[model samples]
Target: MTNPTVAELIARSNRLGADPANTNYAGGNTSAKGTETDPVTGEPVELLWVKGSGGDLGTLKPEGLAALRLDRLRALVDVYPGVEREDEMVAAFDYCLHGKGGAAPSIDTAMHGLVDAAHVDHLHPDSGIAIATAADGEELTGKIFGDKVVWVPWRRPGFQLGLDIAAIKRAHPAAIGCILGGHGITAWGDTSDEAEQNSLWIITTAQAYIDEHGTAAPFGAVRPGFEVLPEAERHAKAAALAATIRGLASTDKPMVGHYTDSAAVLEFLASEKAPALAELGTSCPDHFLRTKVKPMLLDLPADASVEASIARLIQLHEQYRADYAAYYQRHADDASPAMRGADPLIVLVPGVGMFSYGANKQTARVAGEFYVNAINVMRGAEALSSYRPIPESEKFRIEYWALEEAKLQRIPKAKTHQGRIAFVTGAASGIGKATAARLAAEGACVVIADLDLEKAQAAAAELGNTDVAIGVAANVADADGVQAAIDATLLAFGGIDLVVNNAGLSLSKPLLETTEKDWDLQHDVMAKGSFLVSRAAAKPLIEQGMGGDIIYISSKNSVFAGPNNIAYSATKADQAHQVRLLAVELGAHGVRVNGINPDGVVRGSGIFAGGWGAQRAATYGIKEEDLGQFYANRTILGREVVPSNVADAVYVLTGPELSRTTGLHVPVDSGVAAAFLR
Candidate 1:
């Protein structure tokens, strides 16, 4: 018979409720066929269109499929777990996906590309209830389909799953597709019809089996309990638990375990089956990597001692660590030191569901999902037979395999600007402009703050459609103006990442000859201005949770104290100290505060003006033309200090490359200050 039509198959899939419902806000996606441009050649190629972020599969239209370039996607899959190189991959894919040759790639593009079928279809089918719910799924699977199907245990989808599929293709070249135990299924074919048929067959077969044997009644129930504690007592208990978890993990932010009233959970705890339930972990082995083999079940009277409850939790956690260590040791290779270390990614609370932990939020979420799904599956599976995951040996190999570990290694832990943001003050001019430009070039959303409103706007315009730069005007000494600048920055980009306090005024004056008005004028813009801007920027930086960097632009005069420069010297000294105080106060928030002291910067309007440069040259007894050489020769490297040099110092503190060193005074004076000391 002729292959079923794509429309007909999709309609049938919808009728069977296999496709995600468009009206169901959280339902999944669908796709179509089209073409996109090639990034390298700017040529159009055939593409299998996919839904955009918000499109629902049930009501999906032809427009929903994004027309992604299959060839480009295939290339990306070959480089599995290549998130670190996502920028390059995305750029290429966008060119191929949209025919734009420079658009952004979709987040799911990688997964869609690697499926290796003409019309690949995927969804979290409710038939997940069948495979996941079956406690004796392995035997049940055998009884159901025998050798016609392959059973691959559950692994977190995305890079790891993709990589595993690639490996399976290499090993069992004829295997059509595999069941992702406790998760979902993948069906593919040369045509959309074939793919949908495969999917329908899988779902219907599973449904038939579940309909025949699945239990309808709740397996267990939890009894009610009461807690009569004062508000203060409850607050104290939560705070103490939060603190304890944080301390144990050496992290400031830990998952705060929640108190739940699930009857299923309470009944499970009160039942004689609790110990047996603890012995068998989540339904599938994949969950072992998440919630561990067991949860910490708390069993105590409502009025039981608080200390006793806490002590039990602590003891369970310690036991988890010990068990995890033992598992690692047991499976670890004797010859390899690196192979002998691993830890539990999750903790199970007996009466509570599960508490997943990770170095960051995304990882924690993944762990939590795995645990919840696994528990539900195990409970269902218990009805058929005892719930048993893959052998520990197999789990150890899957978890510790250098290839699988390599997959984890491939995922970028953090994007380039993971923790920091940058603001470049006085960004319209020579040093300031270059500094702002450099910060943007290094992944910072550089906010160009300057008194020269037009110049700042011009500088931003020059950056040319770069998402990493914004221009704002502010007289740094005006508290409201500074605050407004910061507010605008937050509105534009969520939060402030870094502050390049480069906006300042300079004046040359003799010590006794300087008037109070002149001293105040110089200090107001240089020292006081930097202080005000930093103060305004601090609140949002702290709220960002990733500490921040504040770089004060002090001059070399602060260190190489010179004749007739009393006002400049005093102000620079105060600004440098301000950075020190900022470092101390904001360190807890993870902010790194520092100062860059530059001298003899060539090509600038403020201090390097015609008369000022000539006068400074005369003071050193050098000709105006020879000033550049004079300053250049003063440094050990014989390099002239420029705006780019100062910008480099700012970049170092804000970039992902530096993680530890902070609260420093970096001299970008071409060694001029050191020369004076010598």
Candidate 2:
């Protein structure tokens, strides 16, 4: 029989994880005790299904729950003192796994399992944690929750912590939950709803108390508003700033940087006491492992040029790296752990909002989300009293703890473009969307720049709505629009590593029949637009000093003849020559320029959407019934080319396969004779 308790636990865990105020990323866990029939004996067994390690509560599923034999887990509590004393309890939980496939349960599983309640929720809501870790946390927890909540001081999480929790439970049998001073909170109930209610009750009560009487961040300076610029200018300035962060934090490969300058974020950054507030460390302890204790702080000058500011930022980052190394050495214990990566995940840029860096957008987004939450909790803590988090030594313990460190270290390797960024023009549809999707799949952040902002955003969401794909309103023919698009890409993902010049409009008409308007439009988009976008992107690629790619989306018509296609052919011809010329020039700057000539990619493509394809198929003498297959059979390979086929060809040119082969023209038309590079 399906245990309703487990399903309820999963539902409640997701609810808590969904709210950043409740949990950030995969920080909390939920568990339920229920009788599940054993497959072998067909008898009910006492099992504990707890939230598995690294499983975020908001997205928790039944499969994500780890099942353990509660009887076996409890039995090992007494054997720990006689055994090695270290890891015996943790090992017992691992050994009691009902079957394989489920992730190892969190270190708190034993602690949760020891709870007698039918349901439990362990959360680290920011506001609640702000009160729990407050200087008068223990006293305040009692003052607010009274006998409803028990107070437990900070204790290292492990077998010993489990025992401590069990003892607390014996004394506070009537208490709904316990607030761990300088840590988190735990709630229990007869049902999952009750357990979640207890957790929410504690959080709401603490937050209410803090709101009613909290203190501001302690700084002996007046609050000052930062210099606010218009939206376009602010994001442009933010892009320039993000580029520097990427350069500073990256050791071997550059980290992708993301900027946030929302009103709330900017207000937090502009606070005169912001620097001191950032130094106090994260509002929650778990973030110590994610963002470190404090962020890398920078005071960006208003009058400084982007170049000079970047130079200064790099210099400051050098000193910051050394200081971090010294901090590690100062805290080194007999274990003598090797220094962790020195890259600062969070960077506080005064006058602008904070910038976050990660190998990819997902990681950066998580860090950014937590930092914003920390801002809220810190402000609340400031209002109630001076915000106090775990000490640096304790953070060191959490950061370097064997269990936590082990959890982070054992993971999959990076993809080829793990930290790289890509920008695709006309990415709202057709081959461009396919290209952006491919790049995102390979771990490169993608920017979808198209003429239609709404469609671009929709396409980006289709690719992945996780902020990895950014959408911009771009008119490739307009210089300012193209510049804004580039700026949007930079603001969203630090810098551009690949620029696919695929934004073009086609008009198939004979030289004599082509109207002047049609001729100019085709030329402006296919030829002039490519030049403008490539030129705009060249500056940043050169500034980053990182080798990049500039691939033009040419057509088979550039080399082959097509009836009544003079405008399309001429524009494409210009593209082919432009690629060869750009390859020669950009090659010196370590940017490899290439082109993909695709033929007859009709389905779901801009060219076929009531434009050139329909006209060409109508003009052809072949029967209308077989127009779609006309070009497919005309090709030597007799295969219909799709957007993905062109995308794959473009990837080959930009990826490692053709690193030494620039000025290359790849034919993605399943073997074209006349379109072959001569």
Candidate 3:
């Protein structure tokens, strides 16, 4: 129906919004004009239901559609043309809202309301944006879409631009859509489905034309002979760079990584033409909005030390912000609002993969994904003679547009631990995993450091919030490995707010049966690993100057004597002492050191996995099924100690309740008389 209802419109919007290939992350909006009964007045009213600003259409619902009187919105067109104050124009849009506190209608609301169609879809598809941004974009669009699409020149998106679009529609009554040069495209139809398909057809048709005659990435393919470092080495280098850039950029809102270390990324970074082409603007205006006009590029020495790389990165970041300020001043006029934050969302290192940063991991990841897709779009445009992005002036206008700025300004402040970054060792499973998951739930971005990189990633994915959790590989006992893990934490999340030393293993043998290898393994993980990780994390904690937490997951064996567990008991005792010493040493810097001594946690425990469960059962002359019950009954509270229970105790040590308590131990063993803290 040409007069589509709001439900029909929302369904159509979600269909278009669901495909990121069709629209960037929440970058596009949609609208439909229909009739509805005014709830209060009981009269038929014509309304425009447009996608709410900041709400992604793919996930949009009816509530996300800001309803406004269609006639009232169209009437503003005549008045807005002469209005000098953009604030007054914004008030007009706000006044027309039929749903209070609903998403402010998109900046394109006026344009949508003016179009003579039952349904409208506006998006920045990858190929479509490339064509829109080309130097000969308007002429090329005419050739590809023929009579179906018209060309609309760029004007800051507002009442005036909407008027311009409406004029094109009036002149070309048969046109299905129009390309907004240097911005994006808009399509409309009598039916919602037709509108969306029209948008896609234009993109597909434009791409086919490029395939026949357009230039391919003119910079040439990534240089074949360049010295690309090993994958592990490149990851480490990228981690260092991400950490340094995040350190420089983060303040109250610490940046978290949506890090990608793929082969394609490495190729781009290693390209001989990177230093030149990378400096150019983004492939599409929406891409620019997410990644910023251009990434902050850092060129590290081929053999630079981690410390050297970080130092240079900080210096370069300072220059980048300064340049951003100058660029704003060059294009900003009296009407321009205060400059947006100068921190670069994308960081490009010459020989390493790109890193995307945001207030949280989700935003960072989405931005990172867009940048990756933009990479291909840019290459395509480059191949077609040369990729010509919009000028700096147009880029500035869109970036600082009131509507876009409002989206960011509306971001709710982080939770108590929202900006805090935590590194949890041995986070692949059991208590480590539980603790990591809990910390993320409470708002801390968590770095899962474990020997098994693959398992660690799986655990992070299970956490299901990509922006708040990341997995890194490291053997905590190795000094270099510990440092690398710490760097990964910094890379994934800009700073270290807490460190959880929960990685340890045991052979479960008596002193007489303990081999040198078994003893070494026990002491290396329980004692040495804790010592090294704490020492490595200390530098960044001290530098952050905001105070931090270091938690050691010790065991009841650290204090209570146990048969057939000498190596674990002895090494863990040393680990407990280390915590006390660190608490005393680091307390002055706002750092807190504590330990969680847990016992009888049989279910879902990494320590209980393998043949150890059967062995422990046999030690007590009981079947494996009875072992759990026996241990649960042995505790004074007669309760089972689960991984989540231990995780809760760890939180107590790190949370606000015990801020004044350090060098302390919380027993999460359901109450062991012999293992009492006293």
Candidate 4:
């Protein structure tokens, strides 16, 4: 039987975690105390169910909660060593577990258990943290809450900080909660509703106080020529610069990127004090862990040309790397985890927006969101008083904490296509959609580019929303449409790492029956379409300096002399040579160009469904339904080929298995003897 209290706890946590104003993603925890029958003793025992380590309150569930014996948890204080050894207490939490398996306890478990309340919430709301990180936080707390809330000075979170809060609550019976200086807030109550209300009260009161007493322009006036650019120009500039920034960020390790042009980000970038405040960096641990201590600021005027701005960025990046290394060296001790990396996760550019990087898309997006929270905190802090953060040494201690290293090590190994971005043309259905799905499953971000916007978006949604895939409308035969698609890809995921030229139309016609229009239509959508898409995608691919893959979806018909397939076969033959041409030209840049020759992909193929299958069947004296079997019987392997077979070939060619093998054609026609490469 499940405990009602834990269920209510999860419900309360979800409510608190759902709003960005309440807290950033995965930035807070909630808990409830309940009674459960112990399996060994067969008796009712008090248990504390708290949001465990590395979980977001908004998505908390039963398994996400760590249940421990309240008696044992509270008893930890009796044997507590000093704050110097408080980390040992975290390890001790494992021993106090009441059941066989539960979520591993977080550093915050002590704060929830030690407090003598039935319910509690620890959140990093931007409004509350604004007061918390202000230089005069203690004074502000008194002025705003008037004794209803107290203030606790900066202390690294552990068993010690837990005891400090519990002591304050005992001493101030009238207080609902306390503001954690240079951190956030904590509230407690006899019931879940009361706890949530108290938390909301603190957040609302702090925000109202700031609004009443704050400066109209906390970041100072926007500098001349630094205002946000027009929407079209801003995105175009961002698209052009994303690859360069991503390349710099990936100096230490490859990173998936996310771009944000939110109002807050633009306003901050245009402010007079933006550079100085960004230099001081974020205060809250959660903020810095994601945004780094500070961002890599692109110090250039808003109107600077893209080439000049990129040159300046390159220079600034070299210095940023050096400064980061020095920061690590200044505080690192023998026990410290080897400097994780010198690369900055967040980059700020005037007139444009922000670029954030991480091992994956969600991580990168969340990092940007956290910086937005930090921006809000900075706005309020500077308005109330001067923005002040904890000492640099303290930040260093937290950044290099042994506990954080342990958590990182527990992350599972990355998938083969992890951190890769693949652009698949004509991905609304059939081979293109299947290829996109396969790449996404292996951890690549995919762009579903096709002439049909609605179907492309639907396919993208099916692959997994914007984080894993996006849809863009592109007529691959049109240069402008192709360029727009490439630009959209860069803005969505930083740069292109893989290109799949699979958009084609098929038409079966005999020597006399084939018209001039038939020849041009097939060539325009296939031969010229592949060329336009590849040429446009190649600019960013080369700009990123990350060497990428370009795979042309040609056909076995390119080699086999089949009757009444003149136009389609000729275009395929054109595409087949493009593979060899580009492979040689791009080899020096590490861009591998390859081709896939697949025959008889009748089932689920848009090209076949659109009259080509019927035409071919008529020529071969078989029904459209029997065309697949008829082609299969003609193949040496006697097997029917489907969209998935072509998709699998695409995966292998782009994967590490073929990392060194390029300028080659892999057949996916179940062994076509006549179509075999010479």
Number of the candidate with higher TM-score, 1 or 4:
4
Model 2 sits at a Cα RMSD from the real structure of 2.8
Give the alpha carbon lDDT tens digit for every residue of 10-85 in model 3: 7887787777667777877898888877889999898888887778888887777788888788778667745245
Candidate achieving the largest lDDT: 4
Q: Per-residue lDDT tens digits of candidate 2, residues 1-678? A: 446877777788888899877878988788999888888899989999998888888998888889998988888776777323554566667888886677687788877888777888888887777776667777777788889899888876676776777788778878998887767888889887888888898888888887677654333343443455566666666777665577666765577777777666667766676777787878466666667667887665444466776777788778778877877877878874567677788887656667887778777767887787777766666666667787777777777766766776777888876787888999888899999998888878889889999999998888777567878899999999988888878778777889999998887677788998998999998899999999999888877777799999999989998789888899999999999999998888799999999997777787678566767777786654466588789889898888888888877787776789888888888777988778
Worst 10 residues of 3 by lDDT: 217-226
| Whole-model lDDT, model 1 | 0.59
- Global lDDT scores for all candidate models: 0.59, 0.79, 0.78, 0.93
Q: Is candidate 2 or candidate 4 better by lDDT?
A: 4
Off by over 4 Å in 1: 1-415, 464-466, 604-606, 621-625, 656-658, 673-678
In model 4, state the lDDT of residue 7: 80
TM-score-superior candidate, 2 or 4:
4
lDDT of 3 at 108: 76
What's model 4's lDDT at 296? 94
Off by over 4 Å in 2: 81-88, 216-232, 301-308, 332-340, 561-564, 618-620, 623-628
